[model samples]
Target: MVRNKLILAAAMLSSAALAAPAAAQNEQFIPILSYRTGAYAVNGVPYANGVADYYSLINERDGGINGVKLLVEECETGYATDKGVECYERLKGKGPTGAAFINPLSTGITFALTEKTTTDKIPIITMGYGRADSKNGAVFAYNFPLLGTYWSAADIAIQHIAKEVGGFDKLKGKKISLLYHDSPYGKEPIPMLQVLAKKYGFEFTPIPVTHPGVEQKSQWLAIRQNRPDYVLVWGWGVMNGTAVKEAAAVAYPRDKMIGVWWSGAEPDVTPAGDQAVGYKSLMLQHGAGKFLVHADIEKYVYARDKGASEPGKVGEVLYNRGMVNAMLGVEAIRKAQEKFGKKPLTGEQVRWGLENLNLSDARIKELGFEGMLKPIRISCSDHEGARDGRVQQWDGKGWKVISDWYTANQSETEPLVEEVSGKYAAEKNVKPRDCSKES
Candidate 1:
């Protein structure tokens, strides 16, 4: 009986010893709002997987960032705004620091959560989408359109079109048509496009594709009849694939139609088969393929049989972008830790880190993201640290970068950003921050 008691005590002590390390590890929580079961699932799944895999890599390889274990919980939004809000509300206050930051990944959800994040003292990260004017961080304090925004995209699109037509002056009298998803995500680029059209003296027409964008017979018929010089497709999900097919049905030149970042994934053009060949689109700094970061993910996350993506989909375009998104978040947390100690940080604390983020070229290389990211510097006044984009063309099997990086002409977009953000500040009854006064 005494021998049995000693064994029991020893086992209990052993259990406690194992539990102590886990309990002692400070945790930083990130709430992911994903749409893996909607029309956008084909495009959404890979992105969500990439984000998950990167976090897993950090935990598996580095034992978490500087010893703060990262915790991620996903909630299904189904690409619905209401569902997204519900997910945000349910997960906001979770973990130690109350969700380091929120990546809505949807413009509708970003718009809905923008005010909520401010009230909750959290930051809403909209990496290449959302309201372009939100880059005015002074007015939209909680919103960070990190890498680029729709305005930058629109400006880049026009710049590419100009290059093809010879020069900016050559754009005069040319008809540049926009084929956009009817939602806010698609329409966000119109204003900037219009501003560019007027500046360059080009004919601009905006065409809207209905939600889900499956049925577009009438729209294609109009495109066939109108025969615009260039068609800019601002689509997402299955819409992107369908658009490519519809453009083919009309016998339009695939090379003439350029899609935005959301429309440039594998799923977008694969369904169109050979029709997708020569189809061009914008790259969100990075394109499809693996880098050093992906090598680490394969080594750390996949080797452990815990990867979120499928066997061979790790280096896809959307997946790589998702990894970039998570890397930015992790870097922000690491930056925040510099000021807030080596521990889990609150959302507000993370915001400061995001604002002051400076991802230098050498640092990006060290992080194994050499060709995938540009040197970016975020500030209190400008959340969009990088406003450059590249053009890629589908070569029937995979995407190939076709053009050099084109930096958006901020001289044109800046005035609009100021005007619109000023109006938003007045309507929301929020005073814009004096960025110069901020650290």
Candidate 2:
């Protein structure tokens, strides 16, 4: 009986495996490890919606890239690393193109998948977060922290603040406090910020809060005492609202507090509503609201009333980010198909596509994401296709760009990437694969 049960279980497993490929016979599968209901849901939902919506639009509106549909399946991770791994294992092989690419979106999950992708031969695209050194594609192949990372954000934040204050020299006497989530994601930006503070003679104060941070009264009490010139918010979801409310409670000027892009969204501040007005955030290319392609998305997908997982969230900021994620993923697949011929491309081929992926100003404008993303040209040593970002200010109602595009100080980041990536390689005893001699 036990033997029979084993046979039946094996058959069921085979059936599921076989079924996935057949289901994706003429399509590319992109697995989304989305946490739509979790501590991070306020941010994660819109982002996941945008990603899934874009995939849906591509399949329905564009008729599935050269006659191949894009199949995106979501597995909720609740921002948990272990759940993310489980989802990755379950969905990676089911995709038509060997799971094409993954954007875990969570720093913890990204790190966990960093190991998994290496073994699975898939590309893990963690845009604007994750390990900044993963930009050294030579050292950390299969991991693409595209566009920017926390270090980039920190570098740019300092540069922007300096620009606002005339120069770095003017920052000598100022005190800046970092209100960070007590996790790897929040801590990632510290080294760069501290390095800058030391160079410019500014006082740096660190304030940390546990995740899902509803209790920040004490942290704010410290901030209120220090009364730093500016506060940088490195929070997500409910934490963002709580931080804003706390700032309001302590009578901190809303304008002086700046949020990381993820922290400055509608969901983050909207809960605090008008009370958190004038809050500013750093934007990594795309910001809130609809762009050029959004209208088409609404008409094509939502008008037909076919939503991915969430039907109503078509063109919000996080959703647009998700869409952009899907766009990048699809574009990479398309590029791979250009070289690898067509459907059923392998993970390695997709990697080639990702590394070689280019989004020219003309192309971005053409696609209707002109102002949404800086022109990107990815290569072997650099996985982050672009390194520039803008700042936006929140009116009581919406967001508006307050600054032009600015590149992070690569002079500061290059050495750091090399040092950290090199250490990672040495620790693992892994040598970087040479892109020049690809077979």
Candidate 3:
């Protein structure tokens, strides 16, 4: 019986190995760790679709990035950290040169894979989310929080709040509270906000909400009783919509509440009905609605009926973010091809490309991303390239940009990044790379 079991196990392994297609030397692999069935599905599905569709657009229109065809695959994580790590490990070595890089949509998964990917030499691009301190690329070499970080988001949100209440001087003695999801992703901005509160002289409070966050009456009740002047909502998935609804329930003014880019989406407000009106959130460079890139995605991918998202759902907030994330990766690969001869490149080569990524204004307009992105450049020392964001308010019907773009006060955020990243390097026993020595 033992001999038979061993033989059967070998046969099963052979079959599973045979199922995956043989890798083509000229195809670049991109593993998408997505969550389409979970508490966050409403938001995740659209973002996942956007990611998948952009790759499809490249293949359909440009015949892939610089003739090196993209080999994309999706592994659902259901927003679970363990499942996300499993998906990453399983798909990381699929193509001829292994995965070009990975976009772990979940912050938890990004945290889990950071050390592993460092060993594997694969880049992890967390466009607008992930460890705020990971922006210190000198230490976290393989991590790229490209567009922004939680610390940047925190600073920008406070800047907008300061603008709203007259000036920075007016924040003295003001009460501000943070309604955060009880997880690493939600807690990331706490230290930065604390620093900001001290600097601006505001009384700060943090309230934690359990996962899925469907039950928040107690938290909102406390908010109703205390009535903080402004609440910075750091939430995701159902938590965002629930917070909006609960705020409405407690008679909290929606205008006084602000959310990070993660918390701002149509799904978050639509479920709250009229109560969501006047609610505001930050935009990470781009907002909802279509731009030139959307038109191309429609013409190349959607018009061909090979699109990933539902009809007319292609240009929503999260979907646009996903597209932007994918575009950045493709551009990185293209940038790599400039040096690596355009064939399928290894993870290490892609890392070099990411570290050297420079998206200029002219390049942005040429790539059909004119309005969706801004001029930004990445380097060996700084991984969070662009920290500028705009404020948008949700009307009863849709979203409208209400304020000018506010760049994160780097003088304030950089020192904290250095402190935290320095501690991380010490704990991990890592000798940071010297950017000046890098070619």
What would the per-residue lDDT of candidate 3 be over residues 175-263, giving only the tens digit for each residue?
99999999889899999999999999999999999998999999999999989999999999999999999999989999999999988
Backbone N/Cα/C clashes per model: 0, 6, 0
lDDT values for all models: 0.90, 0.82, 0.89
The digit string of per-residue lDDT tens for model 2 on 15-97 reads 44565655568777777788867788778867876776787788778898777777656678999888998998988887555
What TM-score, computed on C-alpha atoms, does each candidate reach?
Answer: 0.95, 0.93, 0.95
- Cα-lDDT of candidate 3: 0.89
Off by over 4 Å in 3: 1-23
Error of 1 at 258 (Å): 0.4
- Residue pairs of candidate 3 with colliding backbone atoms: none
Kindly report which residue pairs in candidate 2 clash with one another: 46-319, 47-318, 50-319, 50-323, 51-322, 51-323
